[model samples]
Target: TQASYETTSVYGHGHPLYYNNVINCLRGEAEPETDGREGLKSLELLIAMYLSARDGRRVSLPLEY
Candidate 1:
């Protein structure tokens, strides 16, 4: 059986809330409730992953990227 708490957390709350937040932010109806730095960090991680795969070496991402 699926864990009740996990299912509720994701389907009932997490997904809808995050979706609404993104929609609202895109429409300029509300300020983002999440930290903008986290999005930047995710982008940095993606770039690092791509660079590492392309160059065949470990890559350290810069904070400004």
Candidate 2:
């Protein structure tokens, strides 16, 4: 995932500084806040987005669809 992020930041966007800035803002490249906790939250958020998209419903956070 990190490698893909790196590649996309460079090739897809063609702007490493801007991409890195966004990455840093989003905490993607930083160490996890509490082991797998932050990761689990991200996965849940992603799944909620996918579900909302598939069902054509609005999903709100803390994630209500």
Q: Candidates' TM-scores?
A: 0.51, 0.42
Tens digit of lDDT per residue, candidate 2, span 1-65?
34444453334654565556567758766542344676578778998899899999987767543
The C-alpha stretches of model 2 lying farther than 4 A from their native spots are: 1-34, 63-65
lDDT of 1 by residue, 1-65 (tens): 75555454535757688789999999999888777788778778988898889999988767344
The alpha-carbon RMSD values of the candidates against the true structure, listed in the order shown, are: 5.6, 10.1
Clashing pairs in 2: none
Q: What lDDT is obtained when candidate 1 is compared to the true structure?
A: 0.79
Rate residue 63 of model 2 by lDDT. 59
Q: Global CA lDDT of candidate 2, please?
A: 0.65
- Model 1 quality (TM-score): 0.51
lDDT of each: 0.79, 0.65
